[model samples]
Target: MTSPQILIATLVAAYLYVVTPGPAFLALFTLAASRGRKSGAWFICGHLIGDVVWGALAVAALVGANRLGPTLFEALGFACGLYLVYLGVRALMTRKDALPRTIGAERPLATGMAFGLTNPKSYPVALAMFSAIVAPYIGALKAADAPQMFVAAFLGFLLADATLIFTAGLPAVRKFFLTHGVAVTRVVGVIFIVFGARSIVDAAQGAMRKTA
Candidate 1:
């Protein structure tokens, strides 16, 4: 049976891995700027939902699929790169003040779906996470514990993602900063560029890694 201590440790490690800045967080920040905190909260909710779904998919793939299959994985990466560039261009061209408060929850929901559907960089990392950490520990737990463990792991991931998304909502605090300038908008554009570039590089390297 997997040791209880080991299970806890695995969960902790998974939590840490998702906390890093990535396309998902960048998307949340971009949405937060245009939508406000209410929107930011929705974004966080959606981001976590995406993370949980992707994390679970990685876990399943690691068990059966080619966790590192270059052909399939690179396709996913390429799709994500194109999407991020589209998102970046939108941010680059959009006027910060042009966003209407009436945007409602649809924006955040779309961000969440886009994040889940397009972001692939995290999949490899999560595949490793589940195999190296979660597997051994979860292996030890009672069969009855599987559902509880899944719920707990999802929550842990949710907490980490929520923290980042909420922080993106921070600049909305002071009206002076919120209405006075485009610095936040510009910063979001830069963040999107970083995500777009990283995704492209990862897709390219996947091919090289396979051919070499």
Candidate 2:
């Protein structure tokens, strides 16, 4: 594949990575509904930090997984999984009369940074998304290609972030969230729990395999 093709593929992978619904999506939805688009935008901005870091790491891993090995990410996955489960349980325990407590409500940037960085699924999911789209071109990738790929992926993330901000700000979307905030929060909690458990299991399996 040519440079342009690889860049485009990487962009597509990044876009899909951000747009996929998960804990971050849920938090954004809650913030947008409760506060407004500005808060959502701030959240996205904060999350951008995590996106870039994870994206770069994912690319590095793609280029050098054999050299770096999976141990570090596996450990991170295990720790993040536990954190997610804790958050999920807290959300599940939210009172019916109260709005679900979102982290970083008072400080969206910090909350977003924490969410983006600590998300259990981000690294693996980003890796899988990029792998699915760009694997065919891996052999053709040179050291110089990494910078271009990163730029393409960053652009993709920006586009998705804009889309999410728009979606979160829509009157209809906000209204729906307002009406069903509790239910939605609970549902998200369930999802987080499931994702966390899966991460834990996957990490444990990886460890076992490594030991064996």
Candidate 3:
């Protein structure tokens, strides 16, 4: 179990790790690029919700720190990897004019879940960092226990992703629906491929580790 300072520090590290580019990053970025910034904001919200779910799962012991063996994790990883590849391929195949993603009410949340859940990196990072950091707090009866930590993580996730979307993705958004949209689409398409391919490789490594 981690102490308070250690717990907070762990979370900062975890948040920073999440903030770095991964499937979630690419997903949010791509969504912003395809959809408008407002849509990107919702997608970011969805990502935060997914983080909260993961954190809660960790706290509740639904996902154990060590219980998820390499085998199981690897299998799960494969599922996410394949899904990302499918998305990436689809994005690449689309025409530039088709990239303006006008989202209905459902898609913002759905896309968020799709990106967060489908990224194997999200699980390991959450399982390893999020679970471990909050494990000690889970036992405490204090108000600053699980809920506080969850809020902190959620907020951290939102800010970090929102920054990226606003900085890089928003411009793409304009190009998509306004001008030079096709070029932006192509870039996003490449990004999806990169993100998806990376997921596949990481999943394979995990799988090999399990077998070995």
Stronger candidate by lDDT (1 vs 2): 2
Full ranking by TM-score: 2, 1, 3
What TM-score, to 2 decimals, does candidate 1 have? 0.51
Least accurate 10 contiguous residues by lDDT in model 1:
132-141
Error of 2 at 115 (Å): 1.4
* lDDT, each prediction: 0.56, 0.76, 0.53
lDDT of 2 by residue, 1-212 (tens): 33898889889978877876566887898898888899989999999999998998877765564235567656655665676577678778868897644556788988899889998778866765565566556556666677888889899999999999999999999989778777777875676576667667766877897799
Off by over 4 Å in 2: 65-101, 178-212
Query: What is candidate 1's lDDT per residue for 1-212, written digit by digit as tens?
Result: 43567446546645754664345544555556666767767766666666777676654553332334446545655565566566556666767564323333577766666666566655654554444344334224444444444565676686776666666668644343346335555554555556556656766775786789
* Error in Å for residue 151 of model 2: 0.6
| Cα misplacement distance, residue 32 of candidate 1 (Å) | 2.1
- Which scores higher on TM-score, 2 or 3? 2
On a 0 to 1 TM-score scale, where does candidate 3 land against the true structure?
0.49
List, residue by residue over 1-212, the lDDT tens digit for candidate 3: 33456346445634654565445555555556566566767776666766766655544341332254444444544554465456556656767456343333358776776666665555554544443233333324233354655555665666666666676455644453345544555554565455445545655765575579
Off by over 4 Å in 3: 1-62, 99-153, 164-177, 210-212
Question: Backbone collision count in every prediction?
Answer: 2, 0, 1
Clashing pairs in 1: 1-140, 2-140
In order of lDDT, best first, we have 2, 1, 3
Error of 3 at 164 (Å): 5.3
